[model samples]
Target: MQSTRNKLIDLLANNQDKYISGQHLSEELNISRSAIWKHMKELEKDGYEIEARQRRGYRIISFPNKLSENTLKWGLETDWLGNTIIHKTSTTSTQHIAHHLAREGAKHGTIVIADEQTGGKGRMNRPWHSSKNQGIWTSLILRPEISPHQAPQLTLLTATVLADVIYKETNIRPYIKWPNDILIENKKLSGILTEMQAEQDRIQYIIIGIGMNVNQTIHELPDDLSEKATSLRIETGHQLDMIKLVQAILEQFERTYETYLNEGFKSIKTKWESYGFKIGERINVKTMNQQWEATFSGIAPDGGLLVENKHNGKVEKLYSAEIDWFRE
Candidate 1:
């Protein structure tokens, strides 16, 4: 059921640039004039710029940049993506909330989002700086039919979704720093973490966590991270509508995921290469045991880095290693 507030928003959106009479709204929504006025005031508090005149009624002048459930749902085109959104004003981390929800049988496409994450973490348990209302902290619940070993491919798919959405929205092309880091000008813009729970060869559920630096300024970031991290606003010179970006990501992921499940990883691998960083370049790599410079070949079919040894005529696939891009 639609709330009176959303219905009112619909009326105003439909009658954009035209004044909507309060009396007509009260009658149409079967509410009192005071109720209509209260809802309008609530909308104003939610960042909507509404113009209310003494006799001409109300008009919507602008929309909020918020990513609330209602804002993400409005005009969002997707079949199952974002159908069930768990929105939070502040939390420890959306990934933690999503893990609990997935364990308790949250359906596929259930998204947990927060405006600010106080205890957010990234790959390798590194602390992710999530300033208040500055970035996206969201997690998605997925129950795929593939085996547990194939779960890593989902990370690649997620990388492509983010790359595609960022380019489409900002017109600034981003590079995927293999596995799942999005980079611009060699600075970190986004990170992805994919966690899974499986039994034997079957899969239970997977939680894909995405942390993006969206609207933070240089001073807002920690002094330690200012040299290595960047936000979308810093790169684009302005803030973006959080709701629109989230909706675009969900729609693009759903569309690309359908293709991945039906076709295969052939096309996905190709797309990842196009946006990949430093492919075909000689770079230094550090593993747990060995550190050497190898010729960066490309990504394997199963989403591993294929690097050729410099000393020997041997090409090896590395699933876990750190690429030293500074020395490239």
Candidate 2:
């Protein structure tokens, strides 16, 4: 069931150009006029400017710049992706919270988000810097019907979603480093960590953790990561609305994910490659026992990194390896 507040937002947003009578809002939301007025006061406190006149209904003149469950749902245009949002002001990690929720039978499209993560981690358990209200730190719960082996495709699919949103929102073309990193001008902008729990051939649940640096300034970043990491604000010369960016991501992700389910991985593979960083360029590849150089070809069907072997002219799919993108 949709919350009454969200329903009110939808009713007002759908008719932005005109006023909605208080009686109509009350009838549609099954709430009294006093309750509706109280809700309006709450929205005003959340930074929403609503215009209400005598005999005229209410219309939202502007949305809030803050990030909250209600603000996020105010103008979010998704069917289910963010319908059930678990927002936190500060937490250990959204990923950790998501895992707990999924184990407790959280529904698909349930999202866990935090304004700040005290112990955020990325792939390989690397500590991810999540300053308070400086970036987007969220996790999504997915229960796909596909087998365990096919789960990696979702990671690649998510990369495409991030790249698409970044380009469209900032107008700066970003690149996807093999596996799960979004880069702009050879610097890190965002990272994705995909974890799944499966039994036999069936996946129980998958948690995709996404951490994006959005509004942090140079001084806000750690000194060690100053050169290696970049944020949307740093690159764009202005702060971005975190709520809007999150909505855009959820909207695009839902659309792309639906397409992937209806069709296949072919489209996702193509889109991923288009945003693939350093494709066709020689890069260093490192494994446990050996290191070699290969031309970054593309992504294989099973989500491995496809590289053209420097020797013998054979193509190989690498499931796990440390790719040195900085090395020539």
lDDT of 2 by residue, 1-328 (tens): 5689988888887899999999999999899999999999988887789999989989889877778889888678888898889989999999999999999999999999999999999988999999999999999999998889888889899999999999999999999998899998888999999999999889999999999999999999999999999999999999998988999999999999999989989999999999988898888888789988888988887779988889878899988877867463
Which pairs of residues have clashing backbones in candidate 1?
A: none
lDDT of each: 0.90, 0.91
After the best TM-score superposition of candidate 2, give how far the Cα of residue 190 lies from its true spot, in angstroms: 0.3
Which candidate leads the pack in TM-score?
A: 2
CA deviation > 4 Å runs, candidate 2: 10-24, 37-45, 49-62, 326-328
For model 1, residues 211-323, the per-residue Cα lDDT tens digits are 99999988898999999989899999998888888889999999999999999888899999999888988878888998998888889988889998889959999888878
Question: How many residue pairs clash (N, CA or C atoms closer than 3 angstroms) in each of the candidate models, in the order given?
Answer: 0, 1
